[model samples]
Target: MVPRRIICCTDFSYNSEPARELAVDYAKAFGARLTLVHVIDSSLFPTYVDWLGDEIDQILARTKEAAETKLQEIANKCGDLSDIKTCCEIGSPAEKIVGVANDEAADLIVVGTHGHTGVKHLVMGSIARSVLRTAHRPVLIVEASPLG
Candidate 1:
């Protein structure tokens, strides 16, 4: 089915650029509402340190702000596309991506893979793999470029 709403999730890594480009192409081609999502993995925060509530709040706020700025830049670059939106949240990347897809009722989800394999894949895990497994709708995975 041609998607009326598309969710494109990126980690702001070079690996995700291809996915973003493909999302733009699909969105433009289908005249879909494109929602760009970036989740700041809260798990990345240091667990060993005891952080004060205010400090944690400040850090999350700063991170969210930075992510919003980047998302806006990406949205601006794709200004020709229709009904573009940006979402920045703090949570597990895979779960948050899926949540956004459900919330947006996205017909399609586009994400980039790090192209990791074997031990590396096992060690680093794969957000794309997780999303592919859990998402109720169609998912398009763009492999990382070889130049990287």
Candidate 2:
């Protein structure tokens, strides 16, 4: 099916850069509006910091700002495409990515996979793997290229 909207998830990792490139290609080829997304995975933040006063909030704010800045940089690298959008969200990566896609009514979701195996894969729990299992729309997973 032809997709009119695409959401590409990026964590600014080396592996994810390839996905960004591929997503842009897909968006251009399909004539789709592309939305670049970066999930902060704020779940890593300590919620039970009872002793901290506003420090946690400050840290979270800074992290979110950094994420937005990085996302903007990536968007800029895509050139001046009027059809492009960027989002910075705080939550579990897979959940937030899928949620943004659903909220945007995206026809396709693009993500990068580390292609980890054995114990590493089990512990890290692939976001692309999770999105593949959960997303209702089509998902394009760009695995790390061997050449790179």
Candidate 3:
């Protein structure tokens, strides 16, 4: 059966637009609801330097605000084809993606992968991989064409 509800995860990166487009296409095709989620990675906070305190808090606050604005823009780009909801959360990307997908009762999850392999993949673990293993629903991963 075609997905009735889709959760599209976006980082607002240029490469991610293809995945968002794919999500928009699926949503329009299946007459499904769309939820565009952008997670503000909390790992940016200084872990060892406790003295940064207030400065760190301010950075986190501003980052989340920017994320909301970007998420709205991404939602708008999803076009006037389907019902689209925008969500911004502060946490780990994979955890938040999975949580939102389940909370929204999504039939499918859409994400973009950097296509990193071998050592690069190990050094920076893939969020899509984590979400794929953790999510209860199916996930669609979009990668850019090599011709570019």
**Best of the candidates, TM-score:** 1
Locate the minimum summed-lDDT window of 10 residues in model 3.
Answer: 139-148
User: What is the per-residue lDDT of model 3 for residues 70-133, given as tens digits with 9 covering 90 to 100?
Assistant: 8887787677765889888988999999999989999999998766679866643478889999
lDDT preference between candidates 1 and 2, better one: 1
Q: Between 2 and 3, whose TM-score is larger? A: 2
**Clashing pairs in model 2?**
none
Please give, for residues 29-128, the per-residue lDDT of candidate 2 as tens digits: 8888999999887778888878887898898899989988888888888965669988988888899999999999999998987767798776544788
Error of 2 at 80 (Å): 4.8
User: Where's the lowest-lDDT run of ten residues in candidate 2?
Assistant: 116-125
Model 3 spans > 4 angstroms off: 123-125
Cα-lDDT of candidate 1? 0.90
lDDT of 2 at 136: 94
Extract clashing residue pairs from model 1: none
Off by over 4 Å in 1: 123-125
- Number of the top-ranking candidate, with lDDT as the measure: 1
